[model samples]
Target: MGYALTFEGLRDLAEGAAVLGTGGGGDPYIGRLLVEQQLKAGRTVTIIDAAELPDDALVIPSAMMGAPTVFIEKLPSGAGNIAALRALEAHLGRTAAATMPIECGGLNSMMPLLLGAQLGLPVVDADGMGRAFPELQMETFAVYGVSGSPMAIASDHGDTGIINATDNRRMEWLARAMTIQMGGASYISDYPMDAATVRRTAVPGTLTLARRLGAALRQARAEHADPFQALAAALSGTLYTHGLVLFRGKVTDVDRKTVDGFARGHVTLADLADPRDQLEITFQNEHLVARRNGRVVAIVPDLICTLNSETGTPVTTEALSYGQRLTVFAISTPDLMRTPDALDCFGPTAFGLADPYTPVEHLTAVP
Candidate 1:
């Protein structure tokens, strides 16, 4: 059985995915827009169980890799997201029986929907990382020894290349260079695997889980209950902290530059309550560090999400600006993220911060 992804569906699913992003998944809004736009055009996305795939089924995961900021300005042109699929098929000499999301958050989640609708392929409901993280190697593929290499990447400019690196890390290096050369936006098709490999490594039913989380939040809000509370209940997740809107302002200052293929930036936020009190957020592709009142409140591996004070929608790190009125929340990471390997991939040092990674409970301790 398959379910169609919808705008209303994405709202809750995006929210849930962001919470699971652990401070690293690119904004879910971009993926939502891509998927919702296509769905509204009468395109349909179908999700299938991984178990249903045949042993010889060629499954390729497709996604965008590079600075999220670049994605907004240098958006996918010529169906850039789907280019990877075609590139991969050319390299493998066989058509993919299915497409699956590499991870479950933000852009990763919905791109599959868009690709599936465009190609008439079914999207498997399972995903590699139950939550979002920084590197390509952080997914279950690493656990299954699935190499991300021998992959294909393409851009809006109609340029495509296949990378056959020794391992996943090399694939990241090569893809980073390609993305930079392509103007900071490139889609990749990778981690070719058989059905058994896919089932053994991935978090089963993650797509279904994303949908359930989305539906639960929508239902709760409709019933006039706390949506966040409902989300916690659904994911076996814990809610940490919710703060007031410190600033409601426009992006007056943005310092962004790409170094070694990373989109790094600092966003200066002016407080709406007190103009003199300014806040600054530093990011590397994803939100990495946040500061307010001369104190560091949130850091990696603990989901730090910005929401509109009025609408309660998530704001992507790439979209953060000078004068946006937002209330930030700290959502604790799920158990899967706390494993030693998972933490090593995304903990404090992964973001290049000096502090040792601390458990989120310490920061968002309930009173």
Candidate 2:
């Protein structure tokens, strides 16, 4: 089905990205605004089916990378996105025929939209993973032999780097180091793939799915229904839990320092649903664990999403602070996201937790 993207269509798409982000992908608000701005400026991107891509089409995944907090403080100039893509094109000696989102959650979902509109390339309505994972290598493309290397990163400051790593892990490290130097954020274009590789590796139609999920949530609320329930219903999943958001206050304490080039920090949650139920969440750019009263309630592989209490919007780890009333929502990952290979890429041990991997359903089981 050929679909034209409208403002209303974009809102739904962004909302879907938030849901699929599983609490770690950055917020979609900025991305939404960016795409909207492009559309208003007479720039509307097209979405092409993955099957339509040429067998030799050079495809790249374009996205914004950094702490969402930094994004709000230092707004993007919108140049980094296209710059990265163009740099990748020039480096590989081949022009890209199309662009796709690396992942279709959070800010990343709309990243390619701006570039696609500006360059007049069709945005493939698919992504590497159906949901978001924190690392560059934790993608289906990597598993299926797509080299994230041969990519490029560009900053608004007019700096760019070609990332040619032996593996995706090295690529993540190198990219992280470069982003810190570029002032905590940069736009990257990666996964130089021919259409054949993209077809085999990516979860096609993710963009379309995101739009459907987002629209369902928004429409449910507008019609006086529960948005959470609407989302759960649309995905054939359930809202596992709803708990008080413990952090919403000022930063009473922020012990932050760069480690291996990552902005690492731990924040305390005080004004939570339970006054005596203080919690702490630790992170390395993305939330890794949540502990309530000294017990680990959530960890990697299982999404630990936080949302504003009043609005139920997803919150990025970088945006967490004290005195902000938030509600944490846990949803079961889609079956595709629960693959053993996928879990290994983002398991508890992957984040340095000593415990073995346990499904959220097991944790939530009646004891």
Best by TM-score: 2
On residues 1-367, what C-alpha lDDT tens digit does candidate 2 reach at each position? Answer: 4566999899989887886675546678887888888899997878888788778888888988776667767878788888899899899888989899998877888888878887888899888866666678878887767789988999998999899998898999899888888988899999889888888888778888788778886787678776556655665533222222223422234455446544477766654334665667677655566676676766666666666555556666666665666665555555555677766776777778776766655655569
Question: How many times do residue backbones clash in model 1?
Answer: 7
Record all residue pairs in model 2 with backbone atoms less than 3 Å apart, i.e. clashing.
245-326, 248-322, 248-323, 248-324, 249-322, 249-323, 249-324
Local accuracy of candidate 1 as per-residue lDDT tens digits, 1-367 = 6666666666667666665553346666677777777777888877888878887788888877776666667556428767778888988888999899888876777777778988888898877776566567767677557888779898887788999998877787788888888887688888988877888777777776666666765677678776555655665532222322333444457777766766677776666667667656677655665666555656666656565555445676666665677656555555555667766766677677886666655654557
TM-score of each: 0.81, 0.86
Model 2 backbone overlap count: 7
Cα miss at 43, model 1 (Å)? 3.5
Candidate 2 matches the true fold with a TM-score of 0.86
TM-score of 1: 0.81
lDDT values of the candidates? 0.69, 0.74
